[model samples]
Target: MENSTVPETKKDVLKMVHKFKTTFQRLLSRENQNVIETDYEKCETNTDIEKKVFGTQKDWMNLFEDPSEDAKCNQFAKHIEDGLKEAREKHLKCEILIPCGLTMRIARDILIMSESEPCGVRGCSLIIHLQEKSNCTELVKLQYDPTTVSTFEIHLTLQEDTRHVVSVRKMMMQLTGCFKHSTYKSTPKMLCLAYKLEKQKLYRANC
Candidate 1:
């Protein structure tokens, strides 16, 4: 009987190699396509999550762009209180409301940095530096029409630190211009003018 096994040809070997290579390439391309699709889906999911959290892209960016003043003030308030050394260690806590025209509009968002200064006569002084938003100047211009100046700073001084109540009261009066019995353009004169007008109308009707 003759040898049953036949010798493999170079052409046959080359064809087998090519087939294997083609199969491997197809698998590699499919894997790459799957990876790209997965990444795209993940990015879309992140976008949706962000939209749910912040409502919109502009609103999300604003959280980082605008200054958080209320949070800063709340952080500062904690350090403002302390204990004093006496026979018994007494704790002194001060609650303060800063009244200023600068804070009227941007009170929540305006950045305030405060430092304590020791005064010779008064107990202490709190100097707060303010920074408004980037477009604050433009916003103020659009909102207000000033007579002499577009923007101004006011300095409020008190008789002493203990007289904060009196100082705040006086400042409130000056800023808002509201008093219990304050007359606008003279109330008596306005009433007299009204009476004269009424009398003249009556006389014309009689004639």
Candidate 2:
């Protein structure tokens, strides 16, 4: 009888997967139908930069899921925002080696974050923290909820990390699961990152 139940459970799981695949395909197909459906970079990159500099204007998503592309993007963006904040508090600068070019030195100060509502939106207020603040620019959005705690957003005018400057937001947001938690005595914040500059694929964003 237990073995019979196992097959039924497998069938149920398959049904769910089928539903998900169908829905995803439908949405993707509709997106593809546009006469000039741009590349995935176009699909994922932030649409605006100047208007998005604050980081407090947005939440993680509009209306769809935990691990969907949108969800993953938000998670990664939150990670970069929080990591930079933590790293800055402990060390004046956190060094990120460019894939092949110069190193980026990010600065963080204790004043960067607070237990209460942050001052003047983070991306704009903290423009002083980025290494490329001049040649390139940034915008950020942050959201906090009694339930979700915190989720952050960033838009950049330069491509220090990816093909398009704004596209880096997707890479940053791709760091973790679309659904996550921080219940047990508060979760960990990264104070350091040490990705090897030469071996791009060896680590998960280094540290």
Candidate 3:
């Protein structure tokens, strides 16, 4: 009886050790997984910080460079040139419009027009070269189709004179009307406005 009892106790001890080993392995795996997740989070945070710091490095470097007569204009032209290239690659007609500066009312009107359209009509696209109050240029793309337009809106304060505001609003209304007409006719038309250049010429003539 004593001999049999000893063997049974040995078996129980072995079983206990095996259970402990399995538990330890599972806990270790869970700890490793947690560590991996924490490291990934840290990596993502660092990447975002790096992007914020380095994204506009060219603009920052330009501060020390000698300024040219057409440096800003050239930069704006380059952005437009690139936009045109992209449009060509996509086999879509592109129109470039300049509203002088984006205003809240103009933006609201654009949003309303865009939301009124349908979706997935691969007809034409719009490239907006927006010049901000700070003289910074931004490229905005809008799908100009019968079905749908992009809903992205850039918020900006109205800083232009009353006359300028009225002109811009008129231009927007005309463009919106064009969109509506195209939708009714099922024929999308490319909208183009060189308003800024024309306005500049008028100013020069007045001077």
Candidate 4:
């Protein structure tokens, strides 16, 4: 009777151990199954910190996202407008590179004059450089002045079909009228006003 009881006890202990082991394994498997997998990537050339962190293949994006291509394009335009504002603050003189996305024959605006004439004078001139992405570093100059503002717009509209448009507008400068005649640097004021108007316009347009 003693030997029989000993065997029964050993069997019971072994069964309990096996059951505990199975339960532990099941728990581990379930936890592993619920764990989410994620991946991320970036451009080969981009060195910006934001680019590094969220450049590609993100498991999560911002809380907000645009659902449509037109929305994305409009966002891009807004970004460009913001960048121009910063450029104006720095008094940065740079060319305006028109992207290929613009439709042909869209009227563009500019002030131009000849180099020989003073900027405020009637015959003053300004130069514009047009180039495509391939030749971005090599700017093709387009000369203009206050008198030819409309003509330049027409030329730009017509050239859209033939060539990529690049804007050579600087951060801020005057070309004609009483504003040009004033000796005071008016780039900041102009930039601020433009930014305010654009912000309102774009916000309403998007709305």
TM-score of each: 0.14, 0.22, 0.18, 0.20
**What are the lDDT scores of the predictions, listed in order?**
0.24, 0.30, 0.33, 0.26
**Residue ranges of candidate 1 with Cα displaced over 4 Å:** 1-67, 82-207
Worst 10 contiguous positions by lDDT, candidate 2? 101-110
- Worst lDDT run of 10 residues, candidate 1, spans 190-199
| All candidates: CA RMSD (Å) | 33.2, 20.4, 28.2, 28.2
What is candidate 1's local distance difference test score?
0.24
Best by TM-score: 2
lDDT digits (tens) for residues 1-207 of candidate 4: 888797456545544653464355445434422111111112222123223332322211221233452343344334334444444344334322232222110111111111112231122122212222233221222222334332211111111112111112332233434345443454312110010000000011123
Q: How well is each residue in 55-110 modelled by candidate 2, as lDDT tens digits? A: 21222122233345344435434544564455444543433322210112111111
Q: Candidate 3 on 1-207: residue-level lDDT in tens?
A: 788797456545544653464355445534422111112122333335323332333322222122541253344334445554464345333333322211211222222223222331122244444333455343445544437443332222212122344446546766778445331322222222111210000011122
For residue 12, model 1's alpha carbon misses the true position, in angstroms, by 84
Off by over 4 Å in 4: 1-67, 93-207
Candidate 1 lDDT over residue span 74-149, tens digit each: 3323222110011012211222223221121121111110111111101212222111222111101011112322
